[model samples]
Target: MDIFSNHKRLFLLVILLFGTLTVFVAIFPALNNQYSYEPLPDSIPLTEIEQRGKMVYIGNGCVACHTQQVRNVEIDKVWGSRPNVAADYAGIERTNFWVNTATLMGTERTGPDLTNIGKRQPSEDWHLTHLYQPRAVVENSVMAPYPWLFELKDSIKITEKDKIVNLPARYIKDKSKKVVATEDAIALVAYLKSLQQVKLPDGTPSPEFLYKREQKKHGANESGGSSALDGAELYTNYCASCHQTDGKGVSGAFPPLDGSAIVQGIDPTSMVNIIMYGYNAREEYGEMPAIGQINDLSLEELVALMNHERTSWSNDAPEVSLEEINKILEELKKQNENQ
Candidate 1:
């Protein structure tokens, strides 16, 4: 009590109390987070180039718009296979003595979440074009173009190994010139491509998305059993980025799904096979990854997707049944086994 009257003693006591509170409130929790959580067993740490790209991502203010987080709510399920967990960011480390690169879980969802973008859109060409001019791939995009990340070259030299970006004629200012990605752009794309979510260990049940919206079987067709999943919504989330909403994919990059004979053909063997096994059209277009397989799409979801593609745009084709897709999947599985 007498010490309270002395300013020096009172000041010392206040400092001690502040220090104690800081230790408990800030330092301890941070230390616990750093030590307690571990990366998922299947999750790979960022490579050297990817680390540089992470720095580029921070430097370009990408965190200001795009989020790396996927909330547990149903609405956020489209962004990722599952919600963000502590293990997801466990491998992240500080950049240096000053910068904390441990978490880049951005604040706003101004742009789509990048949690599973690698699996969703794996095309290097698409990412490069998008980086050069967002509007080239995404019409009506508000994200500013990183033109500085690209260099315009007159022609590809036979000796130099330069990866030319595939840009639409409309976006090209000089018809004679070609655009190539800078090292920064390539690194950034590498970082984006590495953002895939790893699968949980075998036999381990994945966390369910909460508060799922109940909707009628709107993706239903007379030929096919009604799907609980909305085909249009699924297409928008998974396919629309490369194959435009119009079903006409980006020229010289993504082939148009509209008016495709394979899409409208009675035999959905090729369509289903392409979805399940992926396609390589790198000669003229980007390689299509095995999206259905990667996402572990359900039979009902596959039916919905096939039906959506078959019927959307100028395409007018018979919707494939769940049984049909299941049969194809079985056949494919047998072939894989034989191989």
Candidate 2:
């Protein structure tokens, strides 16, 4: 009888120990470190209004839809950068006086990630416009508008005795007389302003590189540039299936080259180099096959096509020279010979 009682007690102790170990080792790591947060370097300090906005974000469950991490290989090919690290969350410690810090160190990404949202679109006015109505900006944006966040007041009224009553309808809703501009809305905007990606000192691209390619074509007026036309035709034939006809590209795979800063803003030399030699870097998507071999496009023709794609559609990139294409071809020949 005594031996059986001891065995039962031992079994209970083992189960408790196993459960505790699982909680600490398996569950904690999965929740806390799956997608670590990393703050950007030289980030602007958040104002009091921004801190208040963060509380609104927490209250409204914005984190439920958007994640703050971006993985390197599988995910970054679509997102354009690597996943965040723990260092990203360091800024939260500086701002919050409360115990529940504004650190989003979660794993699941139910919607588009917000890891580098600040850099993605820098204009506060744009953010305001977007919040007012996402479809107004991005035709396909899934986000819903938070209209209660703004302040809507009636006209200011002053009395001769310095006592004001019955403010004008301009200060309130015309039909209901309800004033808007809730504190939660202001706080939410502040939180969004804080969500900027940190840049490495030398790794950050120039502001020129950040401009959308479609904006670059406003200066050139010549229409019959055959090279660009040829390139557009080639792109439509060879690249459109994966990159999409419009060049917006499928999310999480091919990136948008129409407005891509990388394709249009980088040195023309680099663009030719990528086309001729093809890229096999693990950083990008599956190696862009060396289509230069199968296509047999002349150096001039290739340059024309490249420039066309750079400037055509919504892109506005400058034209590429044949000399640049020749140099790229010569380099590719040398690389092939070495291989």
Top TM-score hit: 1
Span of 10 residues, lowest total lDDT, candidate 1 = 154-163
Model 2 alpha-carbon drift over 4 Å, by segment = 1-47, 74-80, 90-102, 105-110, 155-183, 201-339
Q: Residue by residue across 90-189, what tens digits does model 2's lDDT show? A: 5565343546655664566665666665534333434554565554445577888766666444435322322111222332246343233355654565
Model 1 bad stretches (over 4 Å): 1-14, 158-160, 199-211, 219-222, 333-339
lDDT of 1 by residue, 1-339 (tens): 898799999999999999999999999998998889888899988899998998899999999999999899999988888888888888887778998885788889889999999988877878998998899889999999999998888874422678788877788899888788888988999999999998777896888889998766664567765447778887987788889999999886688899999899988988988988889856677678788887788888888888889989889898888888889899988998999
TM accuracy, model 1: 0.88
Per-model TM values vs. the true structure:
0.88, 0.45
